[model samples]
Target: MRKSFQKIAKKYALLKQGWSPQQNLFYGFLTYIIIGCILLCLPVSQKISAPILDHLFIATSAVSTTGLVTISIFDTYNGFGQFIIMILIQLGGIGYLTFTTFMLLSTTRKMTLWHKKILSTEFTLPNTIKIKDFLKSVILFTLIMEAIGSILFFIAFKNEGMPTLEAVWSSIFHSVSTFCTAGFSLFNNSFMDYVDNNFINFIISMLAICGSLGFIVITDFGLMIKNKSHELSFTSKIVIYGFLILLTFGTAFFYFLEPSIVNLNDSRFLASFFQCMSAMTTVGFNSVNFGVFSQAMMLVCIFLMYIGASPSGTAGGIKITTLTAVFAIMKSRLRGRSNITFLGRRIPYERLYIATSSFIFYSSIIAIGTFLITLTHNFKFEDILFEVASALGTVGISTGITGDLTTFGKLVIIILMFIGRLGVLTFGLAIWSKTITENERKVLKEDIAV
Candidate 1:
């Protein structure tokens, strides 16, 4: 029996070694989703299951951190099922690679080169050659942020008349979810009831902001504070500045243009601020019905979702850094300059290419997903577009019609969520590997009339 077990293990190990890094990461994510789906399909979850498609939808939503749901979370799933969903959200947000690395760290007490490579890709780090420290930092930072967030939320809930145990659990779940930008909510209508509740909105907004800022920026900030001479990384600086600027503009635009929001009798400032933060961070918790939003406000929300939080963060969308790079590149070209500069630093051509490619890939995926869903569902173009953006951005705001989507529409959304979370470009590249020829022949230049 021992010899057979060893033989099987060796065979699996050999097979795994032959797989590429991208393949391994893709398989790992798929395996996690399959396990989550199976668990969710159990009798415990079936009690709340409206349909098999609904269960799969919720499972995919949680695992992809997309937050799109066919039913109210509070009414649909039991405590056991909700717990499972929360676990999936945490795992999905931190990433399968991060989870595997954590497991290896616990069991073998060491990280191998393979682990570092996976971590690097997951975090979008410069190199995985020396990633043990970064991995530790990522774990520690997440725990600390979630812990503090939970405490704040618990205090707020407790004051609102929630019992001790329930309040604690709610706080813990929401803190983790918000910080991961997973957008799972215990409430049926998200934070709709708390639109004017400054305290709750502020707490959630802060958590969302922290989560979407990315671990790289957090680490850089920490190092800068510790050593006065050590400046923050250029990438971190750009992300911070860009995030603040966008948030400011988004908040102001919504406050002035949206009558539904601006007409609120009390705490209108808080409502506007929270919504702006939510949209910018791709943390889809809404304090009000998004369907009631004016066309101008809806467009603003779409734009904010399109230019989402930083890379290596829990949030999705085209990513703020990418948008910033595109603008910089365009400005430089318009000015007849060869170099794209931001913050007194020249952006590398390679990085610009990456940013451009990411934008193109992200836009293409959203367009395709939107087209497919429209074919199956008899919904308005605006509604379908909203849903597609929500899935692609991993933003949960909806027009209150997600639950009515057909099976085909649901599947289309599930695919969009998965691709968005994994990153459209990364997933595409993983499936289609590119090769360079060793021998290159120079091509003659041909002139054409302009």
Candidate 2:
């Protein structure tokens, strides 16, 4: 068995040699989803029979770390099935290349050039950060944070009179789910029962935030603590500040402007902040039913989801950094300034180009996805838009229309979730990008109207 496994591994390694990093990542995630779907289809994995499409959807959702579900996970799947999901969540959260690189580093004590290229493709790290440190930190921090969250979750669940064994399992599952920002809750209502429970609310929120903040910020802080002379990088600063501003603005908007949340008898602020955080972090855990949300509030949530937490994190979307660049470009163009700048720092043209491309491409995906869904499903305009944004953002909190989605709608969302998880830019490159030889490359200068 061991020799056979080694032979298969060798064959797979040979196959990967010719593939680009994007292709590797794209196919790696696809492989995980396929395996997960197959496992979920087994008789032992189901509590009751379900459509193969629903199982495929759940597998995609879990593997992408997007929480949109066409069926009740708790009612449909048994313990073993849930375990498979948790594993998928962890894999998606940490990323496809993380474990592979980590194992290579452990056994060989060095990364192959191909491995470095793949890591760089997966994570856009600053020049100052080393891949070795980043990989180690990603693994170490994920384990540490998830561990702490599990302990607290266990305590909270036990205090609420959950059975010992159940609490233990729930704690582990919720901890991984929240930390990964997968938001695949065992509960039917998704934390609605614990709206007023501060301990649960706080723990879940922090876990998601930590995940969404991106490893750049986390690793920056870690380095800062270890070496006092080290300063936080510009990228880290932008991600941190952008996340804070969105969180504060979203929370206040929900509390003051959303009637249903403002009308809550108590813990109104908590509910507002948690919902906002869920969207911003792309965690998808909701303390409130989005069905009661006004159109205006839904719009606000859509905006939050549109510019998700940060890059190189478990969370997905165009990302805060891209949003910042787009804003800077707008600000500069409005003032007729020749160069774009944000927060007193001039943005490089290369970075600005990538950011602008990402902004345009991301927006296009959402628009196209929404338009496609509209053709098939008879749902509210805002609800359809929200669903598209959520799927594209991989922020799975929805307005209770997921199960009712037509088969076509479900397929659209599944595609969006897959694209979102790989990232709009990554997926686009995988499908349309190609290497251009210098000898064949040509530069054409042209000007176009704005």
Candidate 3:
């Protein structure tokens, strides 16, 4: 028996060498999903006894950091099941190996080369050379941010009359969810009751915003505060300026265009502000019924979700930096400039290609996904498009029609959520082990009108 086991282990090790970073991520994600599904199907969750599709849907939802669900989180799953889901959310949000490396570093004070390589790929870091410090920072920053968010949420909940223990639990869960931008909520309506509650809304929104901003930005901000001389990266500057502009414009647009929202005399501003933040960050926690939102508001939400938050964050969509890069490229070209510049710094061509590729790939996936989902469901074109965008953005906001989707439709969404969370390029790269070599021979060039 020992000899046979050794033989099998050796065979597996041989196959592992051919695995690319993308393949590793793909397999690791699948392992998490399978484990999540098994745990969710246990007797504790039997009362919810969702169809297999629902289990896959929720498992995919949790692991992909996409919050779309076919059932009420509070009512459908038992405490045990809810706890399991929360664990998955935490793991999926920050990533599978990020926490593991943190644990190793804390326990042993060193990261093996193999560990660093995995962490680099998982976080999309440019290199794995000095990932120990990065891992440590990620862990420490996550704890501090989540702690602050929890305390503020707890205070807000206490003000709303929740009992001490319940308030604490709610705060902790929400803090993790918000800071990870993973929109899992214990409440059925997802903070709808707290729409006018300034303390809660602001705390949650701030957490979501901070989380959606990449860790690199957080690190740079920390350096700026601590050293007082370190320069912020151009990418950071673009992200900050762009984020502020979008938030301001999106809030005003939603407030003015949606009469149903504006008609809410008491909480009009709060409602509009929260929804704007929610959609732009791709956090997906809704304070109002999306079903009643005007066509204009729906379009606005779709646009926000598509642009999404920053790169290297839990949030999905095309990402803010990518959009900013594309605009910068266009402006430079229109000006007949030799280089793309932002904040007085030239952006690298490699980064520009990545941004352009990401945008095109994201748009293509959404278009294809929308068409596929339409064939499986009887919903209106707008609603179907909204649902597909929500999935691809990892945004959970829905048209109150998710539960009515066919089994096939739900599966399609599950795949979209997985692809969205991992990213389109990463997914493609992970499945293909070898890079395609381009032919060097060039055909005669033809000039085309711009």
Evaluated with TM-score, which candidate comes out highest?
2
Q: Report how far off residue 146 is in candidate 1 (Å).
A: 1.2
Scored by Cα lDDT, where does model 3 land?
Answer: 0.83
TM-score for each model? 0.93, 0.97, 0.92
- Residue-wise C-alpha lDDT for candidate 3, range 311-395, written one tens digit per residue: 7777888888889889989999999999998767788898899889888988999999999988777788889889999999998
Q: Per the 3 Å backbone cut-off, how many clashing residue pairs does candidate 1 have?
A: 0
lDDT of 1 at 58: 82
Q: For residues 271-376, write the lDDT of model 1, one tens digit per residue.
A: 7888888888888898877888887788888888888898888898888889989999989889899889976789889889989999998888878988898888
Ranking by TM-score: 2, 1, 3
For candidate 2, write residues 159-239 as lDDT tens digits: 999999999999999999999999899999999999999999999999999999999888999999999999998999999
lDDT of 2: 0.93
Compute the lDDT for candidate 1: 0.82
Q: Model-by-model lDDT, in order?
A: 0.82, 0.93, 0.83
Could you tell me the C-alpha RMSD of candidate 1 in Å?
2.4
Error of 1 at 313 (Å): 1.1
